[model samples]
Target: MPEQFIAEESRSIGHAGRRELIAWAFYDFANSGYTTVVQTTLFNTYFVGVVAGGVGGVSPGLATLLWSLSVGFANFVVMFSAPVIGAIADIKACKKRFLLWSSIGCIVSTALLAQVGPGDYKLGMVLVTVSVIMFAYGENLIAAFLPELVPEEQMGRLSGYGWGLGYVGGLLTLLLCLGYLHWAMQQGMGEAEAVPVTLLITAVTFALTAAPTFIWLRERARPLPEVSGERILAASFGRLRHTFREARRFRDLIRFLMTLAVYQSGVSTVIVLAAVYAQQVMGFDTQSLIVLIMVINVTAAVGALICGHLQDRIGSVPTLAITLAIWIAALLAAYFAEERSQMWIVGNMIGIAMGASQAVGRALVSKFSPAERAGEFLGLWGLVNRLSVIVGPLSYGLINYWSGGNHRLSLLSTLAFFALGLLLLSKVDEARGRAAANNFLACGDS
Candidate 1:
């Protein structure tokens, strides 16, 4: 915590290196395949359209609500498990081991998704629940290692590369899946064939891409200090308790988390709902939806790359402020747009801002936390994210359900979240958070 130590830690960034940064970013690429193909595009649509039944056959509102709730349920399980496991990993300095176990869960869950059949609603939902839980938890664990690699100032740009790469990975996966789906359809395959085939591809993608983390990632070399058998269990619980106790003192993080909960819920809801809105509201065909998503992902990749540098130059608070304003406008446009083309325009704008918002947010958290306990803090951040996934969809579902099945009002609700977060964020001091990050890095030297 001394000034000399802080200066030393700051100086080490150039020497401490870029290999860790590359490895960290590669993890994003690996995980994004599942996020794009399995969770977002293919599986979610298949689950709701095929298993839960289509919007026409079932109450689309209810179907969506169920999917959202399922993700929420899965996230809740991760929320409880993640921080404790993270704390243990940190305490044991066994980040690599944790990554290995979590990645296995991710691969297995994706494979299980392929086995789900039509009308197997129960089985499909269960698979979705477990798959997302594993995926999210693994991402959280991987993120905990990031601050150990980069300097405080470079975090925004590094996070941007990771997020941008993730979008690129996601875009690639979606394109491949679309191509396969198109070929299958051309071969006289039905909707059933497209869904299962896509799921299988996702399973294979996760299995193959997960190898890099195990092979390339290196943790700081430290002795494996011994502890009593009973202490391990006690330490996990103690860490969890300490996290909650620590929250009272870290009021800024608590405030940030609260804002993130509301706004990110809206952000994630929009991401999940965009295709549905396009399909049902705009009356776009499947091919058009895929094309639109591809466009958005491409734009997002570009945006993330651009904004990642901007975040470093101008700082995260300012970058976040601008992104939220853009989101507010996009939500308003989605609510009022009369034609399909307009949706594409708004989607492009949303895509441009999405990666930057998330990448900067991740960097912000990393900037504010104690270096050694990054995983524990990220666990709380994940908790908010998962909890919001529950709230956003449920709210959208309820509003749509109540409005005689109109989604316009549901889309409008996002404005409230964006506005609230903007207001709260106005009060956050990014400079202080940066200083805290620097201090945390200094702590590492001790």
Candidate 2:
């Protein structure tokens, strides 16, 4: 491998190291094309209006519910498999291979989503599910590589930058789709035809953006000192068992994870539900939702950068607690916002807090996990991260289903997660918690 491709953690950040961070950040740019174009705005519109035939005619609401549930289930599968895959990379010395395959899966799955069309509800759902499953799995595995690339202190900054890049990426893709839509209209194409083509472009963007990650990023997968005659599956199970057994050594890490699971669920559900709430319950038109999302993304970029720097300075747990408090307030405000403009204001506020909460949370995890098993640990983190979505959105789905499709109560119920997470997070001691995490890794290696 070329020297430029190798991601040496010691040399990954600083004035000289910014390029590496940029490369890392670029991954978000590529992935967000799929997120924004397919997951959030364009595809959801297409799925409902075209595939499901809108409300009272197959209802886009049903498709959205299935999409969320499918993503959650796919992550569950990846969680069960991650430790084994991660353990093999650790033992067989194939970290890059795993990352490569995972990225390819994301690219292929997303691009394939372009193939399903109108009147193909079942097929479209299957394609969307498979694509998101691949994307979720890839995201979990790719996250593990970040710790291997950057220095400990700067992890927060890079994580923020990655999310910032994601916003920028999403913006660019949205712009491209807008251009395509305009062109299609000029050429006398109906809205349906224009949308399918735009969806295809979204998938293409994922493939193009992901190319560099495969070509540029490199991992050394430092060799483990302990030798094992055991096969990969046995070794994975053994390490997983040990991780649980030794977790008692780091009681604070356990507390932190539990706290994060609860609060972050609130955060995750809000992000997932906001667009839907805006379109459905809030009664915002398509153009209004687009504008609001752009505003949110821009503000979110600023939020992530500022909050991330503060996290590095003040402390992760404290920063997170503050952000969660703000989130609780934001959700409450959203629940009551009567005017459309007021809802938009609430979204902008969410953007501000959203970046900080998510970026810092990931940075804190990177700060704790052993660099070698970062992938496996992150996989577990992804498990809880995804499980929250399953529980939060599914409950919301049930509410929506039960209330004769009333979305307001379902949207408001997410607040319970924030309140619960706040209580649990307060129990965590930051300094002692991180130290315990390090000690666990030391004992494992010993």
Candidate 3:
């Protein structure tokens, strides 16, 4: 009778836990619409092909350059601001408030994109830049909540679930956009008219879906004592500097970050170049490329779920190492693929590795971070990720230019980053890193 009672209580607890996780995961679902429809698939092409060419009087090549510059500028802004914002939020115990504001900013900016039409290229650029910066802030803020929501052991699985759900969201959003485009075409709507409608739909989807996260997720971190503006700035910078100065004590954590930066460069490069590679090398048409991406989204979700479970059973770092190995293998396969059928296999492999590596990386960082400093550290994580955005693509582009547009050689160059990351990753001791973070917290408290 006692055993039965205990089992019932455990089941009840599990049910409640699942509810919280779902609410948390839904934010990923909400924002993914923006990523898929606005950032990835439709808006950029619309902006370049229609707005820039038709209205702005720019050549396609120059329009592409302008778009790239806008994105790079936005990333630069976020890279500098994220850590400071995160530190302030931690001090104020206001992560949720910041997240809400950023999310709203992104939603409004995206919705306003419906106003941009042919020859409104400047407006389009401004809106995209602002929306992207806000999205980055929201991403950092939401990640700060991970340590609060679950224990270290469960972090990997929960992170995986969130990422997996995010991909599902992306898939659904893409399908919605595709359906809308098809319908709009039948109704005799041109690309310019139809694209703006898709942006509005994305904005609405993001705003509505993110509501659950705002409603259900609690801010558990306590605020530090209130400070003057000068003191806050001083303290934020001081703490950031101290983190770097104390890197030796947290050697494993620092090592892991270094490794992550290297591997992520390759990952970012692959993401930016994959469609181009398929279109150029494998001769995939527009519809075929879209289908390929859709399949990858599905495979990515599955990979995240599988790796999330594996992380708990083995360890986060080990899981990450395995994923990186798969990535290297996938890249090699992609470089060598001569036929469309072979490229499909490589695409799925890329999906699996991309999902697993990303999920594990986030969870590992959370595990190594003190609960009180999760935001600040995750902010640093964002910084490294943003920096990689510059390094990866630039390297790939340089190699391509040097080789006179030899894309296969350019693709193979990414292997160097991955290999270097894997080597650095081997030196990290996850348990020691967690211990170091705990020790720092204890000393600070004392």
**Top-TM-score structure, candidate number:** 1
Candidate 3 local lDDT, 86-196, one digit each (tens): 888888788999999999999999999999998998998899889989998998888888887776777787788888898898788778777887889899988778889
Candidates' C-alpha lDDT: 0.75, 0.72, 0.80
At residue 394, give the lDDT of candidate 3: 61
> After aligning candidate 1 to the native by TM-score, how far in Å is the CA of 434 from where it should be?
3.1
TM-score for candidate 1:
0.92
**Model 2 over residues 1-446: C-alpha lDDT tens digits?**
12352344335543224455566677778887787777677676567567765532565556556656665666566656766676666666666677667667766766666666777767777776667666666666667777777766767777887777778888788788888887888899875667778767877887787777766666657655465566656777777777788787667767777887787777767766677778776788666777787788788878887877788889888888888888888888988888887987798788888878888888888777777777667776776676776677677766776676677788767888888888898887878867765676677672
Worst 10 residues of 2 by lDDT: 1-10
Pairs of residues at least 3 apart in sequence or in different chains that clash in candidate 1: none
Which regions of candidate 3 fall more than 4 Å away from where they truly are? 1-16, 47-64, 116-121, 226-230, 280-283, 397-409
Score every model by TM-score.
Answer: 0.92, 0.90, 0.89
Alpha-carbon shift of residue 135 in model 3 (angstroms): 1.2
Candidate 1 per-residue lDDT over residues 1-446, each given as its tens digit: 12443344346765443444566677788788787776556677777677776623566666767677777788778867877777777777777788887778877878777777667777877888888887877888888877787776777777788888888778877888899988988999887766677776776776676676677777773423664466876776787786677565566777788888888888877776677677768887777777888888888877777778788899888998898898898888888899988988898888887876788788888888777777778877888787777777667767877785687878877678888989988778877765655664576522
lDDT of 2 at 347: 84
